[model samples]
Target: MSIELDHTIVPSYDKLASAKLLAELLGVPWSPTALGPFAPVFVNEGLTLDFIQTDEDFPVYHFCFRVSQQTFDDILGRIKRAGISYRSSVRGPVDMRINTDYGGNMIYWNEPDGHQWEMLTVSYARQSA
Candidate 1:
């Protein structure tokens, strides 16, 4: 049996605003629920990213997205084009650190709510067909 992700729920203080920002960053349209306090954003085609508004303050947590090599490169280019500071495994910053794990390529970043976001690419060995 293979395990896979259905969706990820991120706690947000301002659902609409955060969703909008994430939507822009993820290059997807923000879709807010008509009767609920949840915002949905799809990425990597079928993966759904959800922002759930909470009554109390939410603690900072880390979330990661595993992408293809080409998608990772595209995001790298997009980050460069946006002129935002991006750090890697060797690059060090005052408050943040970026590095790869499990021999996979990854980029570390933060969202408006201080939640850590990671973009990673894992090269899976192809099975003989």
Candidate 2:
């Protein structure tokens, strides 16, 4: 049997706004769907980013998206248009920059909920010996 990720719970102070922001940034469709006490944002056909409203402090999570070159360009353009600050690396200086590491373009930014989000055009692969 193959293993695949179905869904994940993302804690946010404002579920709807956070979900909407993510959807718009990623150019993905999202809708409000009641899932128990959580409001889920369906990022794709196979992945659901469930936003759980919370008041207590929680650890910030990092999410990465592997996208095509065109998709990456579109998203990056949107980000720049929105005046969203991005960085070449997680700990690097904040600026509108993209890293050409691993022979792929990558940029890092944070959502409304302060979740670290990364978009890359290529996936990092390990060479077999």
Candidate 3:
């Protein structure tokens, strides 16, 4: 049997809003409430992001999604149309640029809860391995 990531709990100040926003941006389905007070975003058939409400402080996490060039373009367009600021580099300023240094298009943006979301057309991590 092969191991795969099934789900993850994402801490959020407002679980519903956060999950909804990510779902809309990724063109995925999200449920306002799921088992045990979770606002779940169905990322795909195999993975789900369960947004949970939290008041305490938590470190922001970085999540990267590798997609085809067309999907990347579509997501980027939605980000732009929604007035979301994005940067080419992970820690770079929001120049609204896409990084091609990794042999593919990549961009990064932060959600309201400060979690970093990344989208790339190619898998640089896979290439290095």
Return the top candidate by lDDT.
Answer: 3
Report each candidate's C-alpha RMSD, comma-separated, in the order given.
4.5, 1.8, 1.1
Candidate 3 residue lDDT tens string, 1-129? 799999999999999999999999998999995778899999999999999999999999999999889889889988998899999998989999999998999999999999999999888888865
lDDT over C-alpha atoms for residue 121 of model 3: 86
What lDDT tens digits, residue by residue, belong to model 2 across residues 40-126? 777778898888889989888999998999999999998898889999988788967899977889999988778999998877654
Q: Please give the TM-score that candidate 1 achieves against the real structure.
A: 0.69
Model 2 TM-score on a 0 to 1 scale: 0.90
- The number of clashing residue pairs in each candidate reads 0, 0, 0
lDDT of each: 0.68, 0.86, 0.94
- Which residue pairs collide, candidate 2? none
Clash pairs, model 1 backbone: none
Report the error of model 1 at residue 114, Å. Answer: 0.5
Q: What's the C-alpha lDDT at position 92 in model 2?
A: 82
Q: How close is every model to the real structure, measured as TM-score?
A: 0.69, 0.90, 0.96
Name the regions of candidate 2 deviating beyond 4 angstroms.
Answer: 125-129
